[model samples]
Target: MSTMGNSTNIFWQESPIGKLERQKLLNQKGCVVWITGLSGSGKSTLACSLSRELYTRGKLSYILDGDNLRHGLNKDLGFKADDRTENIRRVGEVAKLFADTGLICIASLISPYRKDRDACRAMLPDANFIEARLLEDGLHEHVRQEIQKAFTSLHVLERLKIFSPYLDLISLHSRSYIQPGFTGIDDPYEPPLNCEIEIQQKDGDCPTPGAMAGEVVSYLEEKGWDVYQQASGSNM
Candidate 1:
């Protein structure tokens, strides 16, 4: 692995303005929200909804839809498995660039292959990769647990104090996000355990997206990002 990487090594030019400076100027941290689900599962909707929520709160964000990119950046790629993998690989790089600019990049892609998705996550620094699952048709409790167990292993790897990496992850799901052979179902899904947050769509006794948005906003605020917060009457 080391030899292969060395063989492919190329010069990495440093940007005059680094990620930290960019984030500081933008008053926000940049990261990628990789939204994956079956077609018509509302991944795009969730991305748009989350983007709007972020926008109102004074944060900048962008969306890279899988279908839309085929018209341009990924035009050369086809639907063959290999082509699809390459397509997603390019998208990952683009998403990382957007995140580096202090803009939250919402990448709504089918991204079916677990290995491919994991590879995309690996492209960025730890805690920068967030995988959001849209559960429209629903999931069995046991399966959810299994997926969570799989995800838990990946997240808790930053225990060492020295050179340890922090992770920021969350999962969201609901109805209208299901399909035959869809991820988390016929196909395998790796859900996150110990996620920072989770939003359930139309849960029997759950909160609405608006409520979840508030929760997310609160999280961002707590993290010191410049998010739009409602004016409070507190005089501290």
Candidate 2:
């Protein structure tokens, strides 16, 4: 049991068509790869790349990007601590639905707070949802990409320096009144201690987001949830 929903006096309506039935039809077991980190952490890149890789391997996957959601479903929400928690909660519900229906739902968001991220984790059963943390070192390619796409020809080093103090403060505290919901500013972003798969793009590893995506796919395969396994008539 991952979590208990908020509603009371309401019962869950079990679907006549279960997850196994859907998975067998789709040739894949559903799961949510919740990618959590700060902005410019390469979550968007990872999500898209992973989705494409899975698709190429004859698997069904979808990316639910944070910015894309804000333009529609979460548009009404502001950047307050409570609003941020609610945002993740809503995304978790959607991801749960996607996972139940045999789809790999990749949720990329700057889910700053540890509690919020944990709540999302609780929404799915063990192994169904994985927390993928993208650390600063893994974002070297992200820095390069963002710089190239910058409208003002901003320097990457300068930007990192600007954001460093805030992150340092966040490392010391869980919440701050000044930055409100901004992680590493006024809000804290608790790094995952034991994530299922930690893709490190460090000094000696594959440096591209695509490579990290492949690593995630490989990790999933090792966990006995390979999407391709279904096609071979093997049970996960």
Candidate 3:
């Protein structure tokens, strides 16, 4: 029996099937690879690339993208601090369940708060929760892209013309276009201090998505997560 938060009279339920049994059936150890970074930092791209790579290698993996989840599972949640905390908490629990089922779960999100991320990490076993932090050294490139995107839209271009007098001011501030409450801009984005993996751009040049995925795959192999004996007629 257990009680949590506002709920009472709750009891823990144990499944007859164990995690080891599921791991044997799937022929791979379960774990969660949490990819976190600022917006436009290629977190989603890496998640997709990693998933495809794992699929080709006969490993099962699932992706829980933050924006995609907002369409349904977290539709009602806002961008407020408390709501963001709840969002991460819910996703962490779901990822924990997926890991228990012997599937690799990749969660890509701009989980800016270190405390929130640490709380999620606490929900899983020490080694099972792998935090992959993406340090984007291409801030100028990102700003350029944002400018190009704005100019490509006629409406945005008109707005820019109306504010052309402030163009010099905007040019002086690299992050002037960033709105209030934006993570890494206005709001704080506390980076992970002890993450297991760190992916970064080199010399202002971001590696190809495939190459980044390969790095993560190599890590998994080195950690023995990529090694599994094949079972006859197994299709996972």
Candidate 4:
């Protein structure tokens, strides 16, 4: 209703040097590697491993681990749903800024909701968003299977009755609700569909972590991200 409001316009300015300039100087393409999974999953492990591997290849990269960030950047936040959402939003903004500056940003967090991850993806370009899944495997799977088998060995009704007290305790609390297809509590994790890559828990033909790192590095190289060329271009 105010004529002055309609006359207001924002101004756009061009930077002397842009993202491509920084990317050229950094000798690598900037992107985001978002790792998601439950607690005790291998998100942090993979992020650290990838950072080391990239360093060995002379590619610049930074890893943002959950505990490391929460200790400072997000120390005041709690685990409430809204707090969780805001935490992820802030992380996404920071990661996008980092990527814009030509740094490969690897965020290892239990970003549970699909909505949160999607929000991150929207902030980054399609070519720059890489979703890495950390699956449960190795010793953890073996332990879980052994426990389940042991529990199954007992008579069904007897087993239920034995754990009835614990079930009663759980039933007494009703702080959260599970949506269909949801698999976890404390946070709800939605697996990525059509992801760029999926890391399996069972080590296959590869012998060690180095082999896995090599595979990832090779994949990134094949994607036309020539860090050396970019860096050289920046210098020229």
Model 3 per-residue lDDT at 175: 39
List the global CA lDDT of all models. 0.68, 0.77, 0.83, 0.70
* Candidate 4 lDDT, 1-236, residue by residue in tens: 23443464645567999999897777678998888876656677778788887876677888888768788888888677777788888888889988988888988888887888889889998879887766655654565455444434333534566556755454333113222222353235678776676766454322256655555666677787763333334352
Number of clashes found in candidate 3? 0
Clashing pairs in model 3?
A: none
TM-scores for every candidate against the unseen true structure: 0.65, 0.75, 0.82, 0.71
Off by over 4 Å in 4: 1-14, 142-186, 203-207, 227-236
lDDT of candidate 1 over 80-135, digit per residue (tens): 66887899999999999998888989898988777778888899998787777655
RMSD of 2: 8.9
TM-score of structure candidate 2: 0.75
lDDT of 3 by residue, 1-236 (tens): 46776778877888999999998888888999999988878899999999988887778899999889999899999888999999998899899999999999999999999999999999999889999988865773577467555434534545666545575455445335544466765467889999989999877688899988988888888888963333346545
Clashes of each: 7, 0, 0, 2
Best by lDDT: 3
Better of 1 and 3 by lDDT: 3
What are the C-alpha RMSDs, in order, of all predicted structures?
A: 15.3, 8.9, 5.6, 6.9
- By TM-score, who's the top model here? 3
Mark the regions of model 3 whose C-alpha exceeds 4 Å error after superposition: 139-179, 227-236
